[model samples]
Target: MNGVIVGVRKDSQTYVNMKRKACAEVGIMSFDVDLPEDVPEADLITKVYQLNSDPDVHSILVQLPLPKHINEENALGAISIDKDVDGFHPLNIGKLAMKGREPLFLPCTPKKWHKDKGAKSSCSRSVRRSNIVGLPVSLLLLKADATVTTVHCHTKNPEAIIKEADIIIAAAGQACMIKGDWIKPGAAVIDERSQRPEQEIRIPIEASKVAGFITPVPDGVGPMIVAMLLRNTLDGAKWVIGQ
Candidate 1:
């Protein structure tokens, strides 16, 4: 898949080498770009769209951590939904949130005029973490075919929202964000980065008593998302190839 790696011009050498070396071993095409000069957010998006619209190009990835001045949200919005292998397109995000209840435009056809095309899904809800570490929870629930709700460091009334979820995923990078007291008592809780610094750490509260099928802090949901990205890429390639 041809892709333009935006935002990291000179520093992109390492990642390009890495992608080539890694994908070459498996005989998969690794496409890219390296925006060496610091550019405006719109310019970065324009470059990505140029490559994204190319029929020969199947995927587009803007290497993230773009320069501090660039607007990341807008640049990310530029990628076409069908080729959103990184899974950041708003259209793809909306489609995922719908859980197949709504129609997003497939690559072959125009669909979904405005945001109001679908019925409500058995929607996912969010949990609160005290810190900036709850980022990976969405990646975990994406595997369960559940959308992630955002109740993070800045959110208020975290306790009340935790009760609404069919699933609860917590990775606040804190010791424990959701105690057994805060949960719905039977929802699934996945801790994606529980064992990052150490293999064993005590949870602040006993969630297994309240939650159903709680993931272990060490080996639960972390590896699954890694596998999910690989599976998505492999699965998506067949569709791009019309197989």
Candidate 2:
């Protein structure tokens, strides 16, 4: 199977490199398309279309946080649903939100880890409502018959809402945003925020003391996300091959 990654910016390059390594480990041919930070939105969408038509490329992923000038929705929408291994297309998300409907592929971040960790029946709270992770995950939890409360920036008494959850999925990009006091004792915490050396604590160390289970920033949800992406890519390839 073949996969193509389109990445912009330094951090995106770093992420793309990790994905390429994962693809290589699994014997999936990986292709890279690095566009300049200043590349026009039209050009980026054109690149996606090119990959979409390539029968050899079974999966196409565009690294997130494209340049400020680019429209993210337009770029994601350009990817063919068959090859949208990242599962960000509007149609995919639309299907995910409805009852008795399934998207071609579930977004990687919201797919596997929770089930593996046995959080399906837990009362869950998803922090922040961003399309990338939080919103989709909340939808998944609801589908699993888990009661879900979503806490966003506009949420009043956020701590009170959070304390009631049996499981928390924290993806608010702000470092140390969810304090120890905000978490319920013995609750499971999945910290999905990415970390940098300068900002090592996405969830404060104190929160770990209070929570029964919490994922460390660098080594935890990050690797699982990549694994699910590879899984989705492999599934797409199998579908193409009539498996």
Candidate 3:
């Protein structure tokens, strides 16, 4: 496993460290490239390409929030799809949302919530339609034979839509955006929003009283994504070794 971090923002630094710790726990060899905040775009992309070409490197993670001057797409696109453990490549995401096609890897965060069983014949509401979370989760639910309704900022009567579903997944990145009343009683809820100071603290407290199973913000969804990344790295290694 290798991490290429550019310019160190707090979130990027924290997550890279978390990945490193997880790598350590799982016995994956981890390497990092901490470039200056002002590193040239070409230089950064070259580093990613180098990692992609290295046979020994099974997984490649470039922490989010790259420096302002960097072209996020070009840098991320330089990574081989096979080594895109973060699953940010357009090809990977496209295949994930489409039917009858499999991606090299599922987006780590969303894959954990994309259940193969138990959600069948259920109606689920997914908040946000962003590529990373909402869209993929909805596709996964559809693959599981569940009816999925996606709600975004522009949706009307969002609460009414949410209350009708048997499952709710909130990934809007907004704090306390979905309240307890929005969740159907006895419904399973997965909250994916995380921000500093935890402005969304009330949802879990309130939802727990009504929800059949509620995932707490801090201990709930985030750790699963980390585990999936590690699992993806191991899977990537297996693919590389043809075992």
Candidate 4:
């Protein structure tokens, strides 16, 4: 979880080599699961259940959009919630919606995490932001310890949403969406612009250097997001064992 942990793949030799190198560096062992496209739904379910039952299998993930006949809902339901690190467990959803308790697997995205973890905290302050994308800025606001009351876009009152955040994460791609006066000034102004013009790159905020930890344009959050997904996979494995 700490270092760059990548999946070792059989598809491409390059990925396999990269994964092996990473494994060797960290003294991690690689497990090979037979990923046959031709595998039947029952067989796939059986294999997934096998992994769920295996103590050595820290996590079991039946990749999304599995073979058409696999009956995704049925297969997913068959997976033990404790092992459903992807958080597909019906029980997890139940807990999230009803109990307001932590799901067996929580989406690590900042905003999602905040909504769950920050539920108990009071919304003491507000910061308005226009985001290029909605979730990222909401995540930044959550990370900054600001509980977002509302999130809106150009179609709605962009300023109104910004006015709500104590720190405005101005991500709405509209150039110059937030005026200088719109912000609390010296309040966190996270402006995410382009770093890689060819690609839609996302830079994250460095909480230490910036006004108070902002998700910069194309750098910070994306990398962290990958790491979190990996973590969620590991946690999902743990959840299955609990069941």
What TM-score do all the candidates reach, one by one?
0.58, 0.94, 0.91, 0.50
Q: Which should have the higher lDDT, number 2 or number 4?
A: 2
Q: Lowest summed lDDT over 10 consecutive residues: which window, candidate 4?
A: 1-10
Q: Candidate 2 at residue 31, lDDT?
A: 92
C-alpha positional error of residue 125 in candidate 1 after TM-score superposition, expressed in Å: 4.3
Give the per-residue lDDT digits (tens) of candidate 3, residues 45-94: 88888888888788888777787888889888888999888788989888
Q: Which stretches of candidate 2 lie over 4 Å from their true place?
A: 117-121, 194-200
Model 2 has an lDDT value of: 0.86
How does candidate 3 fare on TM-score? Answer: 0.91
Best by TM-score: 2
For all candidates, what are the clash counts?
3, 0, 0, 37
- Which residue runs of candidate 3 sit more than 4 Å off their true CA positions? 1-10, 115-117, 194-204
Instruction: Give candidate 1's total backbone clashes.
Output: 3
Residue pairs in candidate 2 whose N, alpha carbon or C atoms collide under 3 angstroms:
none
| Pairwise TM-score winner, candidates 1 and 3 | 3
Candidate 1: 10-residue stretch with minimal lDDT? 107-116
Q: lDDT score of model 3?
A: 0.78
**Residue-level lDDT tens digits of model 2 in 71-187:** 998999999999999999989999998999998899999897545655567789999888989989988888887889998888898888888999888888777778888889999
Clashing pairs in 1: 5-33, 9-35, 9-36
